[model samples]
Target: MLYKKECKISSEGFVIPDFDFDSADAVIPISTPSITQYEFDSFQLYLDLLDAMKHDKSSNFYPSILIKALKMFTASIISQKNNIPNELLESYDTPGTLLSLIDPNTDKTVFLEALHAAIAWTGAVKNNSAFSVPEFILFLIETSVYALSDPNFQYDRNIGNSTVALLRNILFHSNDAKFHFINNRGVELFSSLYLEVVGDTLKDYIIIVIINSLDVSPTPPFNFVKFVENPLLKSVFGYNLRSATSLEIRLALAYVKISPECALSFLNHIEIESSGIEFLFASTDTQVLLLELFEFLVTCSNETVVSIAEKKIQWNVFLPHIPMSFDSKLMKKTIQVAVNLFKIGHYKILDTLILKVLLEMMTIGNIKIKHRAMDAIRILINSGSPHSMDSIIGHNIISKICNFLESDRKDIFKFCFEMLLFIIQFALDGKCPRKVRDQLYEAEFEAIMEEVCGCELNEELANMADILKEKFDQLVAESETLEMAELENNHEIIEEEDYDDDEENEFHDNHFDNMNYYQQYAQNCMKGIEEEDESENESDDEEEDEWVDADEFPID
Candidate 1:
C-alpha cells in the first residue's frame, strides 16, 4: 500500500526555502521501505549538520541556515503521522543540542535565533510520546538557569524577549519543571537581571515569569520573599522616574501578597539614607501602591508580620510621606500602623521629630488620624516611664491634648480626657518632671476639666471628668507640699554646709599654731647646743696656755 501526505508550511521559517512536500500529485506510499530510508537519512543529515555547527570554531556556516535546518527538522518530526522511533530520538538528542547552542555570549542575532529554534523544538517534542522524557525537561531548566546566571550577558530587545519567552514556556510545561526552576533559584537569577539590563524590554516578561513561578510554587517559598526583598527591587522604591511603572508596583504587590511578612522584608530593604520613600511618593501611583502595601501589612494579624512591623522603629523615611499623602485611606491605615506600633511599646524609639508629627496629626489631621494619634499618645503616656513622659511633655503635648477636649467628636474628647487623667496621675506620682507638673497646672488644666463637667457627657465620661478634676486638685496640693519640703531640705543642707565650714576653719587655725610651736622648740634646742660648744672651746684654750707655761719651766 502507498500513502501520500502533505506538509503544512510552518510560520517559524525565516530565510529557509519552502518545499512542496504538500504537493497534491507527489504521493508516497506509507509502506515503501525506500521512502522510510529517505526520511531517516534526511533526519540524520540535519542531525549531522547540528553536530557540525556545534563544533564549528569559526563563522563558516551562518546561524540563520542552522536555525532554519533546526526548524525543518523539528517540523518533520512533529508532522510525521507516527512517532519518531525511540532509538532515533535518543540518537539525535536535538533538544540537548539546541540547549547547548543557547550561549548568551554569542552574537546577539545568532543567540536569539538559536534560542527560538530551541524553544520551537521543545514545544514540538512536548507532544511527542516518545520524546516525553523527564531528563529533557531538566536539561531545559538547567540551560535556562545557566543562561540567565551570566551577569555580563547582554541582550538586545529580540534576544531578551525571546529568552524570557523561552523560560516562561519551559516553566509552563509542568509543575515539576516549575518546581525545578524555582529550586535552582531561577527567579532570583532573572530578578537580578532587572538591575543588569539597560531598559524595560525584558521587565514584563521577567515579571510574568516570576508571577507564574510563584503561582505554581507550593506554600509560598521563602525565596519568594528573598526575591522581592532583593536590594535591586528595593532600589526602585526611590523616586526614579524609570522605576515608577505600574508593572513594577504590581510586582511589589504580588510579592507582598505571597506573604505579608514579605512587606516587612521590603521595608527592611529600603535604604533610608537615600530618598527611597520620597522617590516612591513622587509618583502618585507608586505612593498609592506603597500605602496599600503598608496598610495590608498593618491589618494582617499574622504574628510574624506584626513582629516585623514592630521592629521598624525608624519612621524617619516614612515621616515625610505620611503627612503629604493625599490618599485618605492610605493615611488612615498608616496611622493605624503607628497606633499598633505604639501599643507594642515602641514609644522609647519615637523621637522628638516623630512626636511632633504625631502632635500635628492630633491637632490638624483628619478625624481618623486624630483618633489614632490620641491612641498612640495614650499608649506612650501609659508606658509610665520617665523618659516616655518626658518625650510627651517635652513636645508640649499637654497643650495638644487640651485642644482635643473641645472636639465635636465625642470619642476624641473622651480619649483626650482619659489621656489627661493619665498624665495628671503620672505627675502626682512624681514620675514626670516637676516642670511638667508646673506646666500642666499653668495650662489651666483644671478649668478644662470643669468645662468638660458642664457638657452633657455620658455618665462614664462625666464621672471620669469629675474624678479627673478631683485628681487635679489633689495633684496641685501634693505638688505644693513636695515643693515646700524640697525648700526645707535645701535650707537644712545650707545650714549643714555653714556649720561644716566653721569647723574646718577652726581646725586649720589649730594646725597652724601646732606647727609654730614645734618650730620654736627645735630652734631653742639648737641654741643650747651652740652655747655648750663655745664653753668647751674656752676650756681647751686655758689648758693649752697652762701646758705652754709648764713646758717653759721644765724640759723633762
Candidate 2:
C-alpha cells in the first residue's frame, strides 16, 4: 500500500485492493496530465483483475465493481476525444459506460448490460483492433457465462447473437479448448438459451441457429456411435431430444448431424437407471424429436444398438410420444431407424414400456403422436424382444395390438396387420405369452379375431387381409386341436363303461348303430325341408294349417 502523497483515496470507495494494481509495473502517477496514459494504466489494472480472477474466483465484490471499473476506464478513454458523436456512444456496437450504472444486486440489469457489453466489445474489437478481439471476446463471453444466474439473458438480441457466435467458433474450430468449452458450457448455456427462447416470438431465428449448429461436421468425437456422457448437455437437451414438434427435433438433429458420434452419446444420456419413460415423452412439444432421434439411431452401426440396449432404458421416452403428423420425410426416416434397431436387437429397450405407454396414449394423444405411437407399437410387438420377451408377452401387449387393428384409420389398421404378421412369426419362434398362446388354440380369442377379420375383409382393407388370414388360421388350428382332444377324451369315457357278456356287447353295438342311423336320417330330412321351403311359399301353404286345422280340431 505504498502510495505517493498525491494518490489519496478512502479505503471504502475502492473495492479492488491497492495490491491488485501492483502487477502493473508501468503504472503512471495519478497527477500526470495525460489522461490517456492514466486510462491505459487503469486498463492495465483490468489485466491484473483477469490474472487475479484466474487464480481466485471468489465473488467477494459484487459484479458491480467490475462494471464500475469498465465504465471508469472506458469513459476515461472516450472523454479524451474532443468531440465525440452521441450516436457512436449509443449505437448497437457501443452503449458507452452504461455498464457502470448497473447495480450488481439487481442481477437482471447486470445481466443485460453484461450481455450487451460482451456483444458490443466483440464488434468493437473487430472494428477497432487497437485491442485483441479474440482475447477480449473470450473475456466478455467468460464474464457473461459466469453471470448466468439471471434467466432473462437469452431473450436479448445481443446475448443471442454472441452465444451463437461463440458456438459457431467452437464448432468451426474443433480443437481441445473449444471442444472443452462446448463439452462444459455447450449443454448448460445452449440448452438454457433454447429453453428460454424455445416458444418465444423470435423462435424462428433460434431454430435457424440450431439448424446451423447441427449442420456442423465431422460430428462430436469424430464418430456418430459413441455415447456422449456430458451431464450439462444431457440435462438441457435430453427432453428437447424427444420434442413432439418438428422444430425442437430439428434443433436436436443439428447436434447429431455435426457429430453422428453424438447419437449413442445422446441415447446414453437419456437412459435412466430404471425402466420407464420420462414425462418428457409426454410433452406435446418434443416427442417428434424422439422419433427423429430413433431414425438417426437406425443409421448407426449394429454394435452401437446392442451396446445401447444393454445399458440404456430411455427408449421409453419414444414410446408415449408417437408423432401422428406423418411427415413423409420424418416417417420414412423413423421407420428405417426402427427397423434397423429391431434388426440389431434394440427392441428389448422398449419391451413392456412401449405397450404400456401406447395403450394409455393411443386414444388421448394428438392425431400425429397417436399415429406415430401406433407405428412404433406395431413394430415393437412384431420385432420380438429376445432378452425381454417374457416381460413383453406377460403384459398382455398382444391383446392391445389386436385392438389397434380395429382403429378407423387405414394406416393404423395396415400397421396393426403388419404387427400381427410379426407376432405370428415371433410366436413360431416361441416368443408369445403361454397363456395367450393357449387362448388362441382354445377358440377363446375368436371374438377379438372376428373383429379384426372384419376389418381386414373390406375391399379397401385388402392390404391387411393376408396378415389377418394368417392369424385367423393359426388361432382356428389351435382351437380345433383342443376340440379334438376333448372329443377323444369323451369317447374314451363312453368306452370305459363295461358290458357283462358278449350278448350284452352285441346289443350295445346294435343300439349304437340304430341310433347313428336314425340321427343321419333325421339330419338329411331336416336339411331337405330347409332347402325346399321359402318364406312366401311356406306362408301360403301353412296358411290353411294356421286357420282351419286349429279352429276345427284343436278342442278334440
Candidate 3:
C-alpha cells in the first residue's frame, strides 16, 4: 500500500539531519514524492467514492460506496499527519443524504452500516476544530435519528447499536449539538426509539442522550417540562426506577435536575407504584435520585405540590425502610426528607416512625446519618405538634440523647444538646404532655442537664446547656406546682367525702329510730284491735243463733 510521505527540509536545501515529523516547522521536501502513482489512484478512488455517494441519494447505485466513503473519511481525519484535506472533511456531508434513502418500512442492514460509518467519522473529527461546524454536527444527528427511527431497526442488532453510538458521539461533541438535537425533536424521536428498543445497551444509549442533552450548566436549552410530559419519557423513567442499570438511573437523576417540574412529574410517576419505593430502597443510585427529587420538591416552596407529593408517596411504607438503607449518604437524605416532611406538617403520621428511625440512627457509627438524624429530631421538636413531640419522648429517647451527649463526637454532643434543650424548653413551656415531662424526669433528665451544664464546652453548647438547665428547673417547678395542685384537690375531695359519710350515718340512725317507733305503735294498735274483734264476734254469734233458730222453726 503506497502512500504519500512528507520529509522535513532545511532552508539550506538539505534535508534536516534530524527530521522531526512532529515539529511544527517541518515541511515536505519538494524533491520527495508527496504521492506515488498508487497513492494518487487511491486518492482518486476516494474522491470517486465521495462523488458516487453524493449522487447516490437513494443509495441504489452501489450502496456499499456510502459505507466505504464513511470509513475512508474517518480514517483520513485520524491518519493524516497534517490537517485533513478539504475534500475528505467535506465528504461528511454525504452521510445525511444517504441516510435519507433509508425507509422506515425497508430493511435497515445497509442503512445501519452507513450510520456506523458516520458515527466513526463524527467521533474521529470530534476534536478537530476545523470540522466542528454546526452544519456537520446537525447532519450527523439527523442521520442517526433517521436510522434510529426505522420501525424495523432492531435495537439489539448491530445496526441499531451503531446508530445509537453515532448519535451519542455527535450529541456529546458540543453543547450546540445537544441543543440542536433537542430543538430538532431529538428527544421526542429518541424517546420513541427507546420504547421500541429491546436491549439494555440501546436503552442505555438513549438514556445517555437524554442526560447529555439536559446536562448543560446554567440552564440547558431543552424544554424539560414538555420532555417529562411525554409518555415515553415517563415510561423510561419508570422503567429505570424499577429495573434499569445504575448508569441509567444516574442519567435519569441528572435529567430530573433539569427542572423542578420535571422532578415532580418523575416523582409523581414513581409514587404511583410501590415498586418505585422498593427500587429506591434496593438501589443506592436510585435512592440518591429519590432524595434529590425529594429535596427539590421540599425546597420548591409550593405547598400544594409538596402536599400532593406527600400524599402520592407512601411515606408510611418508605419510613420503615430507612434503617435498612446502608448507604450513609442515602440515610442522610432520607433523614432530610423526613425533616422536611416534619417541617411541612403533611405526613404527621410518620412522625413516630421517623422518630424511631432517628433514635436508631443516633446509635449508628455513621456521623452523617447521626447528624442528619439529630437535625430531623430538632426539626420535629421545634416545629412538630405537641402530640408528635410527646411521642418522641418515649422509647428511651431521653436516654439516647443523654448517651449521645456523653459522646466524644462534638457534632453529636452539640446536636444532642440542642435537641435536649429544645425538649426541656418544650417541656417547660407546657407544649409537651405531663407524661412526657415525667418520663424525662424519670430518665435522669436533671442529672443529664447538670452534667452538660457543668462540662466545659464550646460557646454554643455551653449556652444551650445553660438554657437547658434553666428550662429544666422551670419544668421541675411547674411539675411540682401541678402535683401540689392535684394533691390539694385530692385532699379537698377526701375531706368532703368524710363529711358526707358522717352525715349519711346520722340520717340512717334517725330513720332507724323512726321505723322502730312506728313498729311499736302498730303493735299496740293490733292488741287493741284483737280485743275489739273478740267483742264484735260475740255479738254477731248471738244474732246468728237467733236467726238460725227462726229458720229451723220455719222449716219444721
Candidate 4:
C-alpha cells in the first residue's frame, strides 16, 4: 500500500525505478501493514539523517546529499504493492517515529533545530526545475507548521530570517515549474499556518508577500496562477480561507483577478464584517486590496453582495466609492449599503449621497435610484441641513439648490424658512432663482411681523423672525426722511397760518416716532390740502383738480 502515487510515464517512456521494496506498486491499498512498516523505517532514517547532519557545517553538501538519498529511498519504498507500511497513529515520543526527532516537551530548542535542518534538507535536494512532489512537500510544509506552532517548542527568531530568505527564492527566483509548485503550495497550505500563528502584526508581513506575488501588472515571467483554477488549491484555499483571522481571505482577495465566479464564491465563503473597520483602515494593503475587491465584488450577483453585506461588510466601505463616475454595478451596491446604513441610524449618508447625486444624478436612469436620490434630499433638510446649510455655507453645490427648494414635500418648504437665513448670510449672488427668492422673502417678512406683534414661535422659526425684524427696521428708518422733506415743501402756505400752541402740541403728540408718525401725519395733511385745492378749483368751475386718484398723491 503506497499512499504516494507513482509518477506517470513521461513522453520519453521513462518509469523511474523504485529502490525501497521489491514489488510492483498498487495505489489503492496504501495503508497496508508492509506499507506501514516501510513508512516507519523511512521516518527513522529521516530523523537519523537530521541527527547526523546537525553539527556538521564542514561538508557543504551534507544536508543536500542526505535529502537526495532520502527522496530516492522513500520513492522506492512507497511505490511497492506489498511491503508498504500501514498508517501509524503514534504520539511525538513514540520510539522509531518522525515525531520523536522533534518532540515538543523535552529539549524543545533542539527539536526546532532538527525540524529546520529537515526543511533545509528538502530545499537542497530539489533540482532547479523540479516542482511538485505532492506527498513529500505537503508532509514537509504541514510538519513545519505543526512543529513551529507547538507551545512546548519555541521557534528561534533567527529561523524567521532564514525562512523569509527561502520563501523569496521560491517566490521570485525559481523557474516557472518550481514557481507554480511554491505558489500552489503557498495558497494551499499557508491558511492553516496563519491560524496557528499569533497576532495580526506578524500577519501583515505575510500579507505583503502575498500581495507582491499577486501584483502581476508589470507581468512577471511566470504565471501567478490563481488558486481557484487548480482543484487542489481551491480545496485547500476554500477550506481555510475563512480561518480565525483576516490573513486567509485578505490574501486570497489580494490574489483574486478577473473571475466573477471566484469573486461571487469568495463573498459567500467568509464573514466579511469580521474584518473590523479599525483593523482594515489600519492596513495600507487591506485598503488597497479591499478597494480592488469591491471593484470585483460589484460585478457579482446581487444576492451574493447582499449576503456578504448582511454578514461582514459595513456601509461605510461603500461610501468612498460613490463619486460621480463609478461603475453602475458599484452604484447599485452603494444604494444597497445605503439602504442598510439607513436602517441602522446612519441616515445622514443618504442625504450626502443625494446632494452629490443632484449634482450628477442626471446620468443615472433607474427609477428606484432617482426616487432614492429625491427622497434623500428631502430627508436631509428635515434632519439638519436646512438650519445648518450656511455651515456647509459656500460649496458650488449651490447650483443644485433650486430644484430641492421647490420640492413638494411640505417639510421641504418648511425647512426652507431657515434656508433663507443661510442664503442671506452666505449667498454671493444675493439673488438666487426668482420664485425661490420671493417665497424666501415672504417667509422672512411674515416672520418679522409675527415677532413685532409679540407672537410665540418655534425655536428655529423664532430665530429667523428676529433676523427679519432687524432688517425691516433699517428699511422703515430710511423711508421716514423722504416723507418729511416732501411735507415741508407741500405745507408752506399752511405753516404761515399756524399759530395755536394747542394745535401744534397736538400735531407733535400725534407724530412721536419718525416713520410711524410722519407716515400718518403726511397722509392726513395731504388729504386736507387736496380738499382745499378742490374747493378752489370747483369755485373756478374746473373739474380737472378732482380727477386725480391715490396714485397721483405725493408722499408728503
Best by TM-score: 3
For model 2, residues 1-556, the per-residue Cα lDDT tens digits are 2222232233422111122211212111221122344564454465345334334536777456655544444333323322333444344333223323222334553444343333224322322322223443344335434433365544433444434433332333234334343444343454455445433423433333334434433354433222223432354355433333455455556555554345555665654333225424434434445455544554455557536644554555444444344334433444455545555565554443545655555555557656765666555555555553455456656676666655777776666566656655555554443355664444344575566666535665674565567665775466566669889998877666543366688988999999999999999999888867766687888886767555556564
| Total clashing pairs in model 3 | 0
**TM-score of model 3 vs. true structure:** 0.55
What would the per-residue lDDT of candidate 3 be over residues 1-556, giving only the tens digit for each residue?
1123443223522111222312322221221223333443365466566655556567564556555554454344323424446665475554444344333333454454445445435544554332334555455455556545665645424544554565565556667766666666767667666676665555666766676677655565436325533665456455545654555555555665676666556666543456436655356666666556555554555555566655565555665666766668667777777776678774444443667777777786376677677767777666747656556664556766776666666687777767776676667676653665677767777777667666778888777777767776777778888889999999999999999999999999999999999999999999999999999999999998777445546543
Worst 10 residues of 2 by lDDT: 13-22
Off by over 4 Å in 2: 1-340, 359-362, 365-392, 405-418, 421-436, 441-444, 448-457, 460-556
Tens-place lDDT per residue, model 4, 481-520, is: 4457668976875676665666877787775666687788
- What is candidate 2's TM-score against the reference? 0.39
Candidate 1 lDDT, tens digit per residue, 126-178? 43322224554344444544445555645544444455655655554556666
- lDDT, candidate 4, at 145: 51
Off by over 4 Å in 4: 1-143, 151-157, 173-188, 199-202, 208-252, 255-258, 273-285, 300-556
- For candidate 1, the per-residue lDDT at 60 reads 53
Q: Quick one: ranking by lDDT, best first?
A: 1, 3, 2, 4
Better of 2 and 3 by lDDT: 3
